[model samples]
Target: MKTRIFQLLPISAAVACLGFAGQANADQTVRIGHVAPLTGGIAHLGKDNENGARLAVEEINKKGLTINGQKVTLVLDAQDDAADPRQATQVAQKLVDDKVVAVVGHLNSGTTIPASKIYSDAGILQISPSATNPAYTEQGFKTAYRVVATDAQQGPALALYAANTVKAKSVAIVDDATAYGKGLADEFEKKAKSLGLKVLSHDATNDKAVDFRAILTKIKNERPDVIMYGGMDATGGPFAKQARQLALRAKILSGDGVCTEKLSDLAGDATDNVVCSQAGQALEKMPGGADFQKRYTARFNQPIQIYSPFTYDAVYIIVDAMKRANSTDPKKVVAAMPATDYKGVIGETTFDSKGDLKKPVISLYNYKSGKKALLDVVTM
Candidate 1:
């Protein structure tokens, strides 16, 4: 089957079509699919990412993008994968069937990894804003790309902080057992042991599990100085809350999954004990960070959450490839990704041979007064 440079508009673009009513009909509707868990426990973060992509699409459409001498209206074809691998592939297949030129997510690495194969087979471009698993881009798939630093980098930085700054002699680890969770925890564990921290225990939990009393009780008995969780905010938040209820004094440490604005609400008063790392610089520290935050809040009526800045930059990165190719075809845009060096809200955006961002920064953060506060930054 021959793919078109612009496919038929999907129902996801129905709202975008409404904006075309008063304006001249667009010469072509360029659809970009976005998939994330919009209906699950981490919906807030997923919705934030979607909103960022929507903001970029809306802005691009307003300015009217031109490619190959044709004015194109960018249409956002958003889908919900519920952060499940099975649903991720289904969503990926749907986007492929809809013939979108590219995709913006599958926020979880578990989802992103499986969905990437589908995109690769279809020759479509995929740029994840938050998926940090090194295996994602390591699968030798040209379609796989991520703007954030990988677990390989994030894990060592977090472990260094725990062993040096926090000065923890012993630590207990818990993971949700998903690809992202296990991979990150394993990396941390490896580095932590090398730093001479005693590994008290290692436990496993489910990503969907809210009650962590069993794991928390077991961890408490171990008397570790630090309790690190490898999972998203959904479970990580509740895990901290339950640990507090159990009177566990060990500080809670986690990777990017558990780091977000929503963690404070979910963890309640327990949020103060949590320290987490994000794969990039804090939004306020980015190049156009302040201005982007102002505009995002004005448009969304809320503060920016995790991945919004990266997703916003991801959209621009995709557009940059399109402009360089002078075409909206996924093949051409994908072929042009390697040569990209676009500057956007994030600092200089460039990718390595493996499709991972070059010169990525890891920003560690802690919550203070029910808000995420920057703790430190390490560039890799």
Candidate 2:
């Protein structure tokens, strides 16, 4: 009996030791929020952004992330705002309730601007991958940050290209009436006038408008050398298609919203007549773009849209801040964000006082044979 008791004691000790080892290496789950219009007309773009974040989260876990000496498992709590301002606010509140340490998303300027206040009030960090409205950062919300350049820069870059490269003497402007569309069109108009381009006419169309013949017919009669559209491809593509159907031969100039890999499908052969500017460096020119593209395609079996690289970098940026702060606490992570100098798939990213990128690059593109081709890259 004594020998049997001794043997059982040793087994019990070994079991206790194994339990302690397991506890020591236990993973602490951390929640990160991603909000985008996942169910709307631009769902593809939102899914692209979510895929980037998910890939980062997966990679981080696979590579072993230790935050403040504890192994951490990142969980992405992705939400859909449906590209509506009211829905955006609701989604923001939901993420806040979910207690995410940081957020990456709200892709549209209209949605992002409304959602930022919720994140700011909750003291959470909100990093936008593609919101280009200057007002997004101008709102004075310390919590708001965007990886891409603002309409203030993108609009002028497109205008300069139209006035100099396209050599357009007169231009007509059109907007989808959303914050991003109108704001970009406004900025483009300001730069176009300063560059001595005649203003033919400016028109407003709702984002959901399908038939643009009335507006396109009016602009066709104006006979402008160029037509600048400030909206997403959903509307802009059809707008361009209708313009061509009306025999309007003017080159269509647009901002990033209308520039997409899917635009050719929407605009058909009229895509050849469209020239657009993206608010960042082209993917092929990004520092880690090629490698990222290969990995992303392998994981998702799909092509990237405009903002996936930015979203991918945004996730890394959030994790970087967590490492710097040594805590997954939202406030602590946010406090560490201002000093960030991390280089990722989108190249180097540094923020200014307004949470805007200190240096931004804009890329111009045009479609040929239903494919987007990079024309030039502008640094600002």
TM-score of each candidate structure, all chains considered together: 0.92, 0.94
Alpha carbon RMSD to native, model 2: 3.3
Candidate no. 2 TM-score: 0.94
Judge candidate 2 at residue 113 and give its lDDT: 94
Model 1 steric clash pairs = none
Residue 126 accuracy (lDDT) in model 2: 98
Instruction: Report the C-alpha lDDT of model 2 over 1-380, residue by residue, as the tens digit.
Output: 99999889999999999999888778789999998889868888899899999999999989989987789999999999989999999999999999999999989999999999999999999999999999999989889999999999999998999889889999999999999999999999999999999999998998899999999899988999999999998898899899989999999999898899999889999999999999998999999999999999999999998898898899999999999999999999999999999999999999999999999999999999989999999999
C-alpha lDDT (0 to 100) for residue 82 of candidate 2:
88
Off by over 4 Å in 2: 1-25
**Cα RMSD (angstroms) for every candidate in the order listed:** 8.6, 3.3
lDDT (Cα, 0-100) at 156 in candidate 2: 94
What TM-score number comes out for model 1? 0.92
Q: All models: lDDT? A: 0.91, 0.93
Each model's total of backbone clashes = 0, 0
Question: Highest lDDT: which candidate?
Answer: 2
